[model samples]
Every structure is written in structure tokens, then in C-alpha cells.
Target: MSTALKSIRSIAPLLDRVLVQRIKAETKTAGGIFLPESAVKELNEAKVLAVGPGGFNKDGQRMEPSVKPGDKVLVPQYGGSPIKVGEEEYSLFRDHELLAKINE
Candidate 1:
């Protein structure tokens, strides 16, 4: 594992929390044109780095998290607590906060 990945793995999320790193926005256009950084839009996509064991239900039953590590998830444009490990940026979000899981 890389030093950055190792550093990120050091974090163990607890209880319905998920650790994720945002997928960087594309700087180049499909037409072979390069766009300025200011013109690039931030994407809501992210990769799951780590996941909590899951939260408890109303009846005290453990509800497993919907997503697992390595899953590509779609997050909201806002929300989530930002975290930093080494030179990489990560975010912590409740399982419910995740919008959708990207199959591709």
C-alpha cells in the first residue's frame, strides 16, 4: 500500500460512519481541450475508504451499512465532515447521507 493509503487506513470509522475520498474533477475536455481550474466543476462522486460496522436500529438490532470499502458512491455537493490524512483529503459521512452507489 502507498504511504497515503496506509495513512488513510489508519482511520477506523465507528458506527454508521464512512470514510471517503472525493474523485477529482476532470480538467480536460473529451474534445481534447484543456480547461482552466476555475472552469472545472467539483463532482459529487467519491470512493469509500473505510466503513463503520453500522448503526443500531430502533429495536437495538445492528443495521449493516449499505456501502462497503472500495465502493464508488455519489455524495451530496455539501455536508460531510472534512478530514485530512497526509496530503490527501477525506470526508466522513453517515451511511444515510450518501446519495447513491455508482456501479461503474
Candidate 2:
């Protein structure tokens, strides 16, 4: 983790809320061509930072979250609460708000 991210470790999500940072869009092509800022598309992928202890199920049993810190996941194009920590921005979402986990 980068030094900036180390500061984020102090924050812990509560009750099934997940904290994530979006993966940065590539600014350069594989062939070494630099792309304009407008040409970079925002990716829907994000890295999980912190996760809350699981939420309670209808039966009152605690259910564990499916994803853990360092896991890359697919997020929705919208929704999720935005958070700003220092100069960096992050997003907070419910466990279910995450679409899928990326293995690569």
C-alpha cells in the first residue's frame, strides 16, 4: 500500500459498509502514446480498502462479508456515498452494492 493509503487504515467501516478506492484510468497506451484526459474512460473497478463486520441476517445471525481488503471488485456506475480523506477520495457502499469480485 502507498503511504497515502496507510493513513486510510485508521478508518474502519461499520456494519457491512465497505470502503473502496477506484482504480485509476490508464493515461498512456501500451505503445507509449499518451492519451488526453478526456480520452480516458472511467473504469468501474475498485480496490476494497476496509470492510465492516458483517450485518445481521433476518434470523439474527451475523453474516460475514464476501470480500476482504485488497480484493478488486466491480462496482456500479452510480450509487455509493462519496468520502474524502485528506486529498484522496473514496467511496462507501453496502456489501451488496458491489457487483462482483475480480480475480485478476
Best by lDDT: 1
TM-scores, each model vs. reference: 0.88, 0.89
lDDT of 2 by residue, 1-104 (tens): 12345477788999889999999998999998999999998899999999999889999998899999999999999988887767788888999889999998
Clashing pairs in model 2, backbone N/Cα/C closer than 3 A? none
Error of 1 at 97 (Å): 0.5
Model 2 residue 91 CA deviation (Å) reads 0.6
RMSD in angstroms, candidate 1? 3.5
Best by TM-score: 2
lDDT of 1 by residue, 1-104 (tens): 12445567788999999999999987899997999989888889999999999999999998999999999999999999888666778899999999999997
Cα lDDT of candidate 1 equals: 0.90
